[model samples]
Target: MKKTLIAVAVMAASGIAFAASNVTLYGVIEEGVVLEKAKHGDTTVDLRSGFDQGSRWGIKGTEDLGNGYSVGFILEQGFNVDSGDEATSGKAFSREAFMYVNGGFGKLGFGRTGALSFAQSNAILTGWAFGTGYGLSSWTSAIGNNFSRMDNVVSYATPVFDGFSVHAMYSNGLTGDSEKWSDNNHYYGIGVKYQANAIRSSLIFEAADNKGTATADTLVSDVLTENQWNALKQTPAWSTVKDDVVKAGTAKKKALYVINYGFEYNLGSWTPMFAYQFAHQNQGRRTHMFGLSAKADVAGGNVMIGARYLFGKDKATKVGASELSVDGDVRAWNIGAAYVYPLSKRTALKAFAGYADSGKEWKNVEAVGYNGYQVYLGMRHSF
Candidate 1:
């Protein structure tokens, strides 16, 4: 009987190979032409891609190991088409690079992949790109998703049952203290999502206090000033900020908490979405963001509208530790609309424009409060 089962499995693998491949190649190329004017006297056309959905090319392969078991891996490369350079500096395999084994219980893998908070954040996205930097998940994915798919990591996912399942990840700290650590510089997230028909909902929770380089912004100043592309490196001013942030961690003996909650319902030609985001770090400084989004089909095209609100820490500590509020509160908002037409099956013609405003405040008031706006038009293609 065992021999018969083995023969049947080999046949199944062969059949699948003929239908599809044990290997695959896929990719997307996106570009955005943006013009902006800021209070800091910055005006220029920033041609971009990989900023929204991230542009990349990748290859993946899968193989049946045997009875209810399989294995697979992915190698992806991200790049910016405008400058013909690597995305996020020349970080090889920056996206996803992992190998996994599947079975009736679930699947286990190692390498880089998604984090709990990052996964939960999809709860709020309106299907639009995240280009504006976690605008949707401003509160939930605050620490950013990188900590989820970090290097030297292991993960596992349970088999889906009734549209519900769980996923978890752990990163091994090959460096730093906590040599006595079990999940040092490590983080974990668990989320539950349900999809029946026209309704969808997601709830996720995560915690981690990574002790190393946390997420930082892009080096726009470096790129624009030098007229060259440079990885967004953290500035010295950020050093102080980072220090405060670390206090939200364990090694630094600090922690940051964030949450994102959202839902959507399909209504024939449109689906409306609403989300709330919140983040609090160390001794009470807090930030909150909320967004409303909707999609509709009109005259053989798709239309989208999105608006967001951000409120930084109040003039007072509202939550965590004390004596932690430094820069005071920063508020921002953006409103935009886009119309996209399907030129062909693989190509799309899109024209979008939007306005963004930022309200900044310095605890000392002697410092400058920053404000800015932007306008953009762009197109994209994929292969």
Candidate 2:
């Protein structure tokens, strides 16, 4: 009788512990074959992984703390299916590793996390770009999706109320410093989102400062007149003086500011997205970008079309007593369709194709004057 009672007591304790904590393991696998072309380069075919979205596995758990409070944690890692290796070097949990506490007020998290702009604009961007194998090749190559993942972040999100919410985040910059208190690298971001029955919108602002060197400006002139060209060639003494001036201005504290807006509207069978962004850097550069895309529901999947434009200008640079202009623009367009045939609830097969044209002028840029085209067949399974 004594042994029986002890066993029952142990089982009861185990059940109670299980009730207080919950854990789950989840992952996705994606692989595909892609054919790509580059400007002035030969076509190449290769097997690829994570073309649509990165392949990753994650563990998440929550512990009930009683009284409308809970503690949760998540650890996710990205990997390559072909080589069976981690995506990032020297780091296991490269995607996300964070812990948070949630209650009626809001959720506060600490650790490494995605930037607010990335999180807010993902859904809207999906409405325009195929996001796989050169779908938004033009926009992404220049404006870069306006997203980045950062470490040493403290993030907070407010609970949704009346279809509105806000998020803010800050990162402590680079790690490993003898005097960490006076570190010069820091990042700050804030965003607001609104979701209604047919419309969704997000606004994000972010800034970063780091003590580093930047290519301040470049001078390009392919259409100079004969006299102008002659003057440039004859100013040997001026070149030496200008070189000294530029060298003295080399080392600088780099700073960047970004303002982004994204919107999506659903019209039953079709969804359209719009995006606008502006960026300014302390290195005398400015950029403006605009994007638009639409998706229409079709037979087992959807068809998408996306386009983007980027304009960049830099302050004139002095070269041999002459102020040279460095300004350029990039424009891209893409249209693709995907058919999804579902094998099961957690698996799907997709095939897609896209085309993009990007051109740059007066920038002396290399490998940039080609039209990109690609096609891919991919599969994704989640568990």
State the C-alpha lDDT per candidate. 0.53, 0.61
lDDT of 1 by residue, 1-383 (tens): 44334434554776843232366666778777766654445576777674335678776667887898888877777788878787645467766777888899897888765565452221222222232332222222221222234555677778878876666666664222233463245555556665668766666555555444222211112113211212112354534553433333233323445565567688989878776656655643467777777778988878777776778764332111123233556666666677677777766666665555555542222211123444545555666
- Provide the RMSD of all predictions against the true structure, rounded to 1 decimal: 9.2, 11.5
Q: Report the C-alpha displacement of residue 353, candidate 2, in angstroms.
A: 2.4
Model 2, 181-285: lDDT tens digits are 443246788878788899888888888764332235431121233234335435766456533322235554346688878788999998888877787875555
Tell me each candidate's TM-score. 0.70, 0.75
Model 1 alpha-carbon miss at residue 60, Å? 1.2
TM-score of 2: 0.75
After superposing candidate 1 on the true structure, give the runs of residues whose Cα lies further than 4 Å from its correct spot: 1-21, 117-149, 173-184, 212-253, 312-327, 360-370
Full-model lDDT, candidate 1: 0.53
